[model samples]
Target: MMRAILPTRALVPIAGLWRVTACMAGAALFLSACGATTGGPGVTPGPASPVVGAPPEPAVLGVEMSPERLAFTPPHLEGMDLVRVGVLLPFSGASAALRSEAGHLLRAAELALFERGIENVVLLPKDTEGTARGAEAAAEAAIADGADMIIGPLLAAEVRAVSGPARRSNIPVISFSTDTSVAGGGVYLLSFPPEEEVRRVVSYTAALGADRFAIVAPATPYGQLVSQAYRSAAAEFGGTVTAEEVYSGGVDSMSQAARRLARAGIGSLEVGRALAMTGEDWRPTDSGAFQVVMLPAGGDDLRMLAPSMLFADIDPLLVKFVGTGLWRNPDSAREPALANGWFAGPDAEMRARFETAYEIAFSEQPSRLAGLGYDAASLAVVMAASEGGIDRAVIEDPNGFLGVDGLFRLRADGTVERGLALYTIRRGQFEVLDPAPVRFGPDSMAVDVEPGES
Candidate 1:
């Protein structure tokens, strides 16, 4: 049992522990819950600062149960604590439309744990109907089944529903959704979301000293939001939006949109990147006016639009391409012609190694998504086995980087801190041009230079 170390307000850093001044304990039962051993980070929370309280303002309302206090209790059945690891995914929904990618990943993840000699790892799998409600149902069912932990609900909204219930149950969640918004108590997302991808991309592209960028995406909100995120993040680093393009329904129908660029005289986003390489505070007014093209889509879509873009007299390489984690797939980098395209993702060799281990165990190549599954399950097992599983010190353990996802930490918010690598394709393979970085909230981190940055 963790002794609630509640420190009064105005207390200075008393030997470095986080102090929380609160009304003395009045433990009235709101809900009858069983007690279990509590454990996690024993690290010190940063020092507190004073806040003025003169003016009356709206008070922040909170839910009944504070998610942070929730603890994960492993069930010991027959002498061994058989962790009921629940995997909630859409194995039969629209995800099936993606050719059983989810199932392949799921199996591979389980197999990885099994190979590690962690035999008592009981697998509890459930299928959501590829909808928010389905995801919620799956999560609730998992909790009802005595699952000590929940693995995934793949989508963002699904994560939202899963988070609350998991928190209420004090069950820690390791999700595959990349949406940062889904992160909170009991939820730890591993999907390389747009924000993480964008941050790495902007950091890499910024080093070129070119401050102008052009972005394009489908007409959907997802597309607009990603584009907007890139633009806003780009300017925060002193960059400029010289040109922007919007297409409808993925890059497959972006041919007409490609032509629109010729009129913009934007030349290529690649040129802008090259300008940034000058290592100066070059703005849109600094040199070649404006030129850049950033497409938020996959390599297949990138390929389809290539011919049209080229036929329109647009130099493909001249317009250096910038992309998100979706481009992390080997197939995405296989266009061969996309050798110059820049994207943020896991290290290729790291993925190759994981795939080798997976294939040896399962007799087949693991899906790309499996990497996330492996990281999530493996981390949970290790964390649970630790003296303090979800404690702030453990979650913030400086060394607890999720190897598969590049680098991430379990933050106090119960959300994860992500940092994916910045890679460029060369000779049909992704070469690590820059090391990954920690995602600083919603802001873009400054790009680091390697020994031979050109």
Candidate 2:
């Protein structure tokens, strides 16, 4: 198959999440895990055939990928008899695949390393049972066993649980969790976080020429956080959110909620629920749909909103439809009532890979939860090869943009900042409407709020 996108010198910074089309470099990119070669002891990865089209396994020598700028500067693993690495995943949780996938990640990482002849590392696997307390115990066990570093504790709570111990022991824990708040001086999150999505949405919408915006939000924690990020990122692009509407509705009163938005000349749950019963005309402004609509809930309401936006021909292009990462699937674009539009979330590449890997490994594609497993494991390998004795260039540089599910950078705080690509449902496919990892520098006016500031 394919080789690491080729070891490069340094990344060439790209501008705007939506403006990039390709990764061009000789000094800064390794687009694949194939073509990998090593000169030391390496762990052989297990079978990893994609259900659809996963790139064939790479040559095995036990070499792993290094983060940008930093490299897999082999931290004395070569002639050291055996290098002990820990694997912490939930084996008995509701989602069995997450736990099992840890093994797959180990396989993948080991294969990536095997080709490099770096075979001295041994994985000390443990189960977190999918809880914070469980993760804490597993992490302690790994450290007690002289594990060089730990990977996993997929859940955010678990990431938080294990961080304290990792910090105390200086045994770097590369987490698959995305709770950016869990980040500390020692814990590292490899999962793409919400911040990257925020950056991607704002930068892309600006590139699409959206000058004004608004958000339709819910009064929940997740809803409020995304809304705030959307609002802030929108401002970074010279755009203004003129309105923010909220709904904390139940099924019994869903219609009444829709009616309220109708009265305000805004699309509301009140009006949406009553569109048919009372024959209330659902009207969008002649200027088109509000510049943007940030929908926060899922499971059912989206089916209702789709038709409303359609019959109104709200011009999704005129009014970009912003949705939570929860809305990244066929249902959002299906129902025959909705129009092709834009949204931000787990994005396309993730959709493509997870679907195939899940089926091959477990006869099913993973849901959002499964994503955490993949993110955590992939990130752990990256972090292990970087800051905590496993120096790799890809995970150490500020200018690097990893194109797995999203782009990310190892911030000084031991947490990662994600950079997701933007997608628009075009024709029948989710097209990469906006390329990601828009480089923001000291000069860029992006606001730098402290992590966990909320």
Candidate 3:
């Protein structure tokens, strides 16, 4: 029942059926290729051809992949065209945790083929081993194997390492790195960047007439990024960040920061508590030092931060609370202090369907990043079926494509923009306060202007 929101040309089928042949043993480079086909009644399966090559070495780029790990290759049919998609991930690494994550990403990509009913596309997974040199080697192997398009190489450093080889081969890459610096020149980032989330939520809050803002964030790198993004978003939306506080360390530091922020904005804790005692309603449009406070943490950090603000006597009823995509967790709704707090994220309904489908297919909950792999593979399928094939023009189409994470477009600059929905924590649930836009406007880039830019 899942339908794609794409142009008519993207749905057109390519001429000729194609099959994937098994990787021959003793090949120079060993790739675990996985191909999917849509079989129907009255269609006879074609015979598979043996891909003869040298046996695999003990290790490729210091990452060992045993034959047992490659045994999941599906049988292929002969005399069919092929659209080879090279998926580079840290399949083997010093960290076992990262290897597990890579497994989830690869599984998600494989799931996209069957779910989309794609018959001609084949997935060629290469192990990056979680290093720049490994990623460069993987990219070289994939390019040498005639990959039509490349997906992943998750880390920013890995993306940078793969970019040169991909450009030299005229192959486009859809990476999962959030670092905007690594984007552009045929490397499109499919990962969620904090800038877009901050922009959306801040714009929405400003539209509600909250002009004065305050921020309470941690001192981590992510917090710094979100803080900078918040400032830019606020200025662009005609709001002023009147006060800010950055804390490091544990819950005590966070609580102290919140208290400091409260004093800076509302004078004293006693006054804020006295103000809360009044049964009078406080609206965003009302004149005050600050009408909204931005908290960009998630999980346990969020659990502690939200209550810290409340304990500082910053009444949630009087001051609006805004956050980024990190607030999408169900646990955020369970926190009584966060009730009525607003955050921006993907379309809830679409994400719910995707999560359900992924859980059913994998028998476990998929990680938040798994959607990037699914969407990247889905893009490959659409491009392969299209008349234009997989190229920069087809990929950078202004119309964009809708996927599991909702509507998103790969910009010519290789940065991605997503249509997000505003949600509020309510009654132990996250409820959509503003639904996500179904499509991009004619001038989608108009809102992407940075602060202080003409």
lDDT (CA) per prediction: 0.56, 0.51, 0.72
Cand. 3 Cα-lDDT = 0.72
| Per-residue C-alpha lDDT of model 2 across residues 1-454, encoded as one tens digit per residue | 1111111222221121001111111101231233423111112232222123223221112223222211122232334545456667665556757645654554434322332223344455466767788777766666664566676777789888888877887767777776778876667776656655665666665775665666656677776777778778878888777666666765423334434433434333334544443211222233532556665555577666544444444434335566655556676666443344556665455345444434443334455445444444344344444444544333445653333354445666766765566666655556665665434354433322111100
lDDT by residue (53-104, candidate 3, tens digit) is 4212222222232322122222442355667777888877679877877867
What ranking of all candidate models by lDDT puts the best one first? 3, 1, 2
Q: Which model scores highest in TM-score?
A: 3
Clashing pairs in 3: 17-80, 18-80, 18-81, 25-54, 25-55, 26-53, 26-54, 26-55, 27-54
Location of the lowest summed lDDT over 10 successive residues in candidate 1: 20-29
Pick the winner on TM-score between candidates 1 and 3: 3
| Residue 157's lDDT in candidate 2 | 90
lDDT value for candidate 2? 0.51
Q: Give me the runs in candidate 3 sitting further than 4 Å from their true place.
A: 1-79, 267-282, 442-454
Among the numbered candidates, top lDDT falls to 3
Q: After superposition, how far is residue 97 of candidate 2 from its true place, in Å?
A: 6.8
TM-score of each: 0.68, 0.65, 0.80
Tens-digit lDDT track for model 1 on 1-454? Answer: 1110111122222221111110001011111133222211111111244222321111111112222433222222236555666677776667444326656656555544543434355445556656777667666666654567777877787778787778888887888776777787657776666866786777666766657777767777667778878888788878877777777654445767777766667444456666655312223233332444567776567666545566656554455667777666677667754556777776554455566555554456777678777776666566556665534355445434535545566666655556677777777777787775534344434222111111
What is the overall TM-score of model 2 with all chains considered together? 0.65
Worst 10 residues of 3 by lDDT: 36-45
Which portions of model 1 miss their true places by more than 4 Å?
1-77, 92-99, 119-121, 129-134, 249-256, 266-285, 289-291, 311-319, 328-339, 390-393, 396-399, 413-416, 435-454
